[model samples]
Target chain A: MRIRRNLAGWMVIALVLVTMPALSAQSGKVTILGTWGGHELAAFEKVLEPFEAATGIDVQFTGTRDLPAVLTTRVAAGNPPDMAALPNPGQMLELAAGGHLVDLSQILDMDQLREDFAPVWLEMGSYDGKLVAIVLSADLKSLVWYNPKEFAARGYQVPTTWDELLALTEQIARDGHTAWSIGLESGAASGWPGTDWIEDIMLRTAGPEVYDQWVNHDIPWTHPAVRRAFEIFGEIARNPRYVYGGTTAVLSTNFGDAVNPLFTDPPRAFLHRQASFITSFITENNPGVVAGEDYDFFPLPAIDPQWGVPALGAADLIGVFRDTPETRALIRYLVTPGAQAIWVSELGKLSANRRVTPNAYPDELTRKMAQTLVEAEVFRFDGSDLMPPAVGSGAFWEGVLMYVGGEDLDTVLEFIEAAADDAYTSGAATD
Target chain B: MEREGASPLVHLVIILTCLVWILPTLGLLVSSVRPAHDVAATGWWTVLRNPFDLTQYTLQNYREVLGAAGMGRAFVNSLIITIPATLLTIGIAAFAAFAFAWFQFPGRDALFLVVVGLLVVPLQMTLIPILRLYSRLGLAGTFVGIWLAHVGYGLPFAIYLLRNFFGSLPADLFESAFIDGASPLTAFFRLALPLSVPALASLGIFQFLWVWNDLLVGLIYLGGSPSVAPLTVRLSTLVGSYGQSWHLLTAAAFVSMAVPMAVFFALQRYFVRGILAGAVKG
Candidate 1:
């Protein structure tokens, strides 16, 4: 009889243990998968602290560099997280098309989101006319970083037009210093910075309409507009006097280390074209460097006065995989200016929400960058990210390397065109 | 047999090879202690110029990785996954190898061929199907699930390796044991396993390191739940998505390397013998 009583006690404990996770999950918990870690992740946790305190909902964040692969596998295994932060719109669209993502318009307060964000962000985050993702942070790419002190000492004026920029480049070259430090190397993703150059130049030379057509492959790679952009980029990248260490150096230098030449005791290059995030790297590598004072940026000058300085940038978008009340609450909270201010201040990333004013940024340079993004005359997402992976990350990236490595322009264009043909056709067939 | 001494030229070549192999690890060790700015600013070899300046080094990277990155929990998870996975593979592989080597069973040769053939199957192809099955069985994201997956994936090579060693054993000892009224089980336990320590020890090290270093299997099965994540998974996430915070990766890499290095050194004697065991015959 005593043994029977003991067995009953053990059964109760076993039953409770088995049901514990389900019980906790039911109360208030949401799992978020993202590609952030270290400092960025810590900042995100801070962003969540207030929401967690107010609602008493537990937030679990899992960080992985391979988010797409992990998310795909989880979805296949029928165990996806409540939400996931997608690095690009491509994967978000793929997931949305698969009916794996919840329609954010249904869960989120659309009226508030419309007020918080610009229409461009909403449109970028939509698929099939339904809001599927919300961009959390953006990084401006069309900027030239130069040392303010060096520029002042050299009597170099920030160029605002393409002609003046060319004349300035000539003057800098004549001054016996390299005009630009263009680093094209990023392991396995080498040649991406080159792609950025082409994209930025494309926006300027061909205007936004043709740039869209180029990204969508409505126009062939051999089109005059595309070639013009590449040639304009080559004028700076290929010239031995224009780039620090010349073409070989441009191809060899790691993007992060490329800017080092500009910070040296005797600067090797006077200009570096990179995204806003380069500031963090600058401060990290060169200790005691102050933003705005030591270094500052101006928009990459207007090539066609009609187009103006269009912003080319990338953003991290969050999509809800499971539409629970907790997830809805979290999404609603994430869009608030208060939450966005904390995130931008902590991580030094620009917030997409227009309501997040410039003061939310930690420094004046970042404030200017945020303003540059918000007040741009025109804006477009990074062209490579919008293209199919086969052409975008694959052929387009390789073409940049080949072109800079002295491959003929015709051959490079044709090479990318062939891949785009195959990729776009198959991409359409699947859709 | 007396071995001739290596000539000076051969010695130089061997020394060069050792340097080439050790340089990267040496660089990693040096960089892990240096400040983040210093690491990014100059090559790790620059420290050799000012080796006496202790001010350049800091334990901040190590503290951040272990404390904030949650590598401390991951270190324990790696051990938990590796120890049981290694033992289970050895245990099961030893029994099967003994059966193939000694017992008279129908389809023994064909079954052995099938098990051996499994080695040619790539691990990636089975992840999805097995994961689907695991989720249905409520084993996904559990330590036991990963252990079983490791065992299953590890068994093909483990069994083949052990079978060859078991087959190479002197037949007289096993025959005499069986004739003295020893059961097949007794022979396996008392004779075969006892004689196969070198092979088993070597296999243990291989399995341990393989499971410890594995990221794909762990990521797929465990799904990066911090509670069950191994060191590899945690280490991969140490850097930002665009590979920022890479200085932390240097420290985290060494933290993960510490255990495998220790395991390899401890079983090193057996490892050398095990590699030579099947290669030579009297």
Candidate 2:
């Protein structure tokens, strides 16, 4: 009898403890989930401070590396957060198709948003003719980083066209130095850097229309356009004289550490093709090196003049699941120039908002990169992120590895095409 | 039993195996103390070129990891989750094992078979269903919910191991105790409990370490709420999503490993004996 009474008392206590949070969650609060942590999370929190002060709505943020799995489970359990910052549009499209996301066109001011954001940003964030997600920050990937000091000392000019780039590579090889340092290894995502190479080449050579068709699997993996992109990449990657330590080093070196050779004494490599974020790694490995002076970037030289200097990049998209008043208020605040300026200045990321001027960036190099992003004549999202996972992350990654490891290109293309056929067909059937 | 000494070749092989196992851990230890720039710029083995250069080492990584927001609270939360989960599983399994071993009850054999069968069910399979139930009960992010979940998942193996250990005890001891007019409760408390100390100690270590190192259960049930998250969850968030602040991971990993290493070393003597407890009849 005593033990039973004790258990009943504890049950009462547990009930009270569990109900407290639910009771306090009535109004004036919004919860968000995302994959940001460390300094990124801190910057996001700083951006939230003004909103919290003005609206008096409490914003609770949850950080996790496994956002997709957690978000799916939460949505399945009928308890999704008010908002979530998706890493890519692929997952957002999946959730929006399932009718789990709230259409932002109903909640946000469309005319104001259109004026602040570019058409490409809005188009990427829309699905089924309704805006469902919004992008706040972007990272430019079509860049070729080189040491300005070395280039000037060696009397080499920055290439502006594909022919000029080839001539520069040959000249550098003749000068008894490697032309490029390409590192494709990123742990399990090893060959993604190589995919970026192909995507950039595709945008330059075949134009954005074909790139979109290619990403959607409208064209088979064996198309001449795709093969041509691969062949162009091969000219630099397969030539022992053009790459730093031959194809073997390109296969083994980590993407983050690959740029260290460019900063070493008597610099082993001249040019590195990577995203704008590579500057962080360069400065980290070599302290006291100034950006824009010690190192600078030029656009990956145009392959076809018709396509012009196209931009290829990735961005973080924020989408809503529960449309409450506080959620509406917070979403409105997030896209404003006031909020975006703080976000970009603190984290050194490029804001997609046109109202956010270059002065919001921390350094001149970042301002230049932001300008490059905003001024591009043509811009497209990263191609691999748009395809089905079986081909994008699975076959495409492995195919690159096999191609670099000396497999025949024909066999590699066939392997990826087979996987794409299965993935896209089954993916459509499930939808 | 008497044992023969190993040959020189066996000794050499054992030494080589030990070296291979210890090399990575040694490198981690060395890297954890070095500055961030040095760690990224050169290999850990390079520090040995000037071994006495005390200026080459710093405790900044450890300081930063320990000082990161919510990490101290997370350490306490880990203890709060792990200790009770470990104790509850051991305590409940002990009584249940005693009942299955000595008590004459209806359907006892069938019940034991059912529990041993539960060991085959994967933990991942039950996460969503249990989470659904937990949400309905308003226990989704509560400490009590996680404790109950851990106990439920741990009970089957706990009972299997303890029942085997308790059954392997001599029947003469229980008979002698009952002959002396002792109740079943008294026999359980005074006889079976004392003799099963080694098995219990080993089981306690296993349960404690499993709960301490667990990430998925804590992540799913706790829902990334910083107030209830454990050390493993907090450590995972110390780096950026793309793993930008990876220089801090070596230190963060070492911090989480400290408690488990201490617990294992303290309770290691009974581990081997516990493994062999039920295998032999004599």
Candidate 3:
């Protein structure tokens, strides 16, 4: 009965096709599976038009946040998409570990990438000494976004050092305005923004080399540098005027949703120190404001020169499956200087291709950001992404909340250190 | 011997309990209608300050979400997957339940026990194998594939429910039919099945809601084909790699709830009867 129905369905399909135009000279399609949706959905679709026109290969895109999980299911079932773009390096590693990825070593031109994309990104996508993914846009996290008019009105200047950054917060607090708007509540993953704060602090206080050691577990979680990062973070979190609703509000507000009040009239708070992505949220809340006049970002200032905190960047890696001659051509087209140019001009995105000029960014601040990213001597990936997720996502977030709620620095550190040990012991790290 | 009126304390306690139970739902309702900025910055009660701020209460969210990412198609796909899964589960379970309750066969108890044993298998453990099977059969990423998967997973509890209702049917009725030389199928259709309406209706509503609200199975098997995805998948897509659009998310949440609420209310009269049927053996 099923076969008979299928036959009848085919006949219907044939009838429909007869009325429509027949296939052209080249019709083989490639499905680019990804999780970009909402505003980004429009951006990706716009970019795809030019690609399809150039290649004559039909490009079918399916967007969902659960794209990785869905792709896992599909690949396990032997019905994988032609290509998939996963945000985390760990996911690419997992796919390669499962032998689900097609090695791109022979095709992709790695030499053409940005000279300074924090080699850690390239390393993250490599497994068994083979490249599986290409780092796309990079996000520089060591930047603090602020209202330029508010700061100037308060006689505040952009802090050049960590001491100045701290002093400036106190100065802002003395003026009776809230110093920060720190919101980390992102349901089920409630404490990630707090984690980002800790990461920024670590990059500023501990230096990148120690940061790298902590990621590799060569330095224990209880190391002095790790402890100090928490101390500095807690100082701000505990100070009543530093954050509105302080500890409680930090726990209450959704991180993405938290940026809104800062952009409101009379401004709920003065500053938010998040990555470049927060611009989208700020843009959403304040409609007619331009970046340079209304808002801008300063590089996260250094506590001392030894801290190595000029910049920190994170990247989303794009990987391949079943690489063939056709797929090779596709990758070459995707990462070439020309393609990066299109991504910037059309999509308003930062491209990982170093050969492409940063001047292509539509906004002045983004172009400045691209220049700063290129000049940075040291860069680090998001520490949480490098750690085993069980500890990184679960324990780390929980630990940050505990610290914010006034748990002692040592106790919080010990709890996370033990959780990390359990994570490693359970074989979660090795895989 | 009756008191002239109930004690004020008792009345107050009942009102308080009702409020406590309804608090989260009320919060969600209020939060759903609120401006995304206000919801983010302050509590939902802020709306009470200037309740008539028509400017703040725009349907722009609803308009945007409905227009977002092929959600209209997802609604149709959800209905397509849910209706058949519900019907097929009820049909198969009814037949199986009738056999379990009325038929006599060697090892019938053991067979029923085996079916009950299946209830212990975690659905997650079986997901990979079942997915592989669907792909092998060319059923992966199809509407029929999801329906069959839902029905297969839904059957054990469904059979258990219907069998209890069938068992309570008066034994005299089946014997009377047997004496009249009516075949089992004819007796089932004419009498037993007709008497089992409440049970079937309740099961249908339950299975429909589960399949409709489901995200994991739909996502894994249906392939996010906008033409085939359900509300849950579409709602999740409103959130992107960077952040969420709460305006759209709130609207999407309300849209997904509308159909299920309608299904519940439409069947509510039968719902009460169905729930109480097996409790009274007559």
Candidate 4:
């Protein structure tokens, strides 16, 4: 009778233990909000799956392009997601300042991250002396794409300096082919390409300190350095002879579609300037053209050759909104090289983690770009993203369109300066 | 008689107007079938050049959209939302509308004046207030939260359309029923509802479409849980705002439109007859 009682007790213990995991799983789920979707979303899930399997932590991802607006609604309703992968450093800073973000230093060995990331990347992730975000993926924007086959067949070589680059562009024009394909149209954000041109030129001509000061509006929009940057952009953008269709086509064509002419028979245009992400569009449009063999990229040719290589890049920063064990674990896993290698290999993305080697990249061009990003002497976040939206997205974007449409440079500069004055002064009051 | 003399011109005008409306939808349909690369690289009109080349098209987009993991649950959520919201609006609007048409009471005109004025209060103005109220009442993220929201927003125009129809019905019908020992409740259930089907039917179509196509309200209240999201939300997440996969968007657009199109066709007789009934009375 004692043995029978023991058997029944054993059965009861088994019943409780078997059902325990199922019950606990319900409450342990962590929700993440991000803007990456489609193939990018698929890549992210693939990268994070191992962590989920290892820890039995269910991670739910929700994506939306308008992440900031959605996050505002959620936070106001007191139902913020457990973590959010923010698209820019400026937005991360805003959330950090609002007391909505949890400090990563409390839960993470942030000093260890110093070994993984470039110092500038880490600085961008911090707000008010607190590490609030860890960057996941980066896109390098200082690339100029060209048809290497056309270059080789014509006995041409890649330019190594700004002057040589200009001469090559003129030579291409002289050959009765268009030298550059430039498009600024992007629907509501129609003038962003113009901003990139100015930012890139500013980095080359004025150096990084002035570039930083200009972005912060520590220097005025009308300053000579800023004007010179605009003038250099105009030399290419405003000239009808250098551009593929005309100066007018620069304002009308969609940025992605601008590269299509480069792959046409005899190659309609020989050169295009865009971020590295344009590879997907180029390969998709021209199915037979192989990367590195048909098309290639080089960093924007140096102007002064003195201050160092200033590469403009963008990264998605993930911040913890709640100090939960699940979120902390996920953040830790994300920053590790093993997890980052999966993302880099799948999406052709760059990792801020130093241990994620260039060999993790999908192709030779991407591998080289990754190495360049890591080894660059100077790097800066996308300038428009760093400024307030009122000036950055509103007046600055609009000013580019006006300038491209033949509005005088001073008028556009004055227009943007007025907006910056209001945005910065109003921001100071809020602080 | 004059319309007969002008008939050919009228037909021409109608044909041109209809062409303007139908062309975009035709383009979307053509785009939905083209390959993802072609949709991005070329115009849909390019199909006209090589109409016989079936290799240029595929059903892959539709397969992806329908086979998406969340679609089945989202389809159910949409039904759960739209059906109840439509029924509730018709039921509540019918009662409020009937009372305004039949009853004699103090400040009746003022109350109705307020109800009509409420029609001008946009849905954007109400979303935040209702969200706060829903959270306080523990209705946030539940099916009932969005259902109540649609009903509230849908009521004003619903009552207005319905009240006018009920008011236009001959007064002698309700009176005869009342005199024959029918209570106002009895008259409402037996007499008023039967004759109001055409009006209610059209109103049902309107309410269903409004609730089905909604993204903002669903996103705000339902919290993107696959268990509670609708098709519009699911499809929207397939394409981010910064970049679009056009072939998927076009296919998803058709998939979401399919149900409303079916509902419209099914209820089209009542839709046309109701408009005629209202128009003939005037």
All candidates: TM-score: 0.94, 0.93, 0.90, 0.92
Worst 10 residues of 1 chain A by lDDT: A13-22
Candidate 2 predicts chain B with a TM-score of: 0.93
- Output the lDDT of residue B170, model 2: 96
* TM-score winner: 1
Tens digit of lDDT per residue, candidate 1, span A1-431? 55347657755654553354345455688889989976778889899999999999988888888777778878877878889987789878888989999998888789988988999999989999999999888989999999989999989998888899889899999988888999999898899999999999999988998888888888889999999999998899999989999999999988888888888878889899999888878887888998988888999989988888999999989999998889999998887899989989987889999788888999988888988988898899998988888888989999999999989999999999988988885432222
- The TM-score, computed over Cα atoms with residue i paired to residue i, of candidate 2 is 0.93
Kindly report which residue stretches of model 4 are placed more than 4 angstroms away from their true locations once superposed: A1-25, A426-431, B1-6, B275-282
- List runs of model 2 lying over 4 Å from the truth: A1-28, A426-431, B1-4, B103-114
Clashing pairs in 3: none
Clashing pairs in 1: none
- For candidate 3, what is the DockQ-based docking class? acceptable
Q: State candidate 2's DockQ.
A: 0.46
The DockQ ranking, best first, is 2, 1, 3, 4
TM-score of chain A of 1: 0.91
Residue A285 in candidate 3, Cα distance off native in Å: 2.5
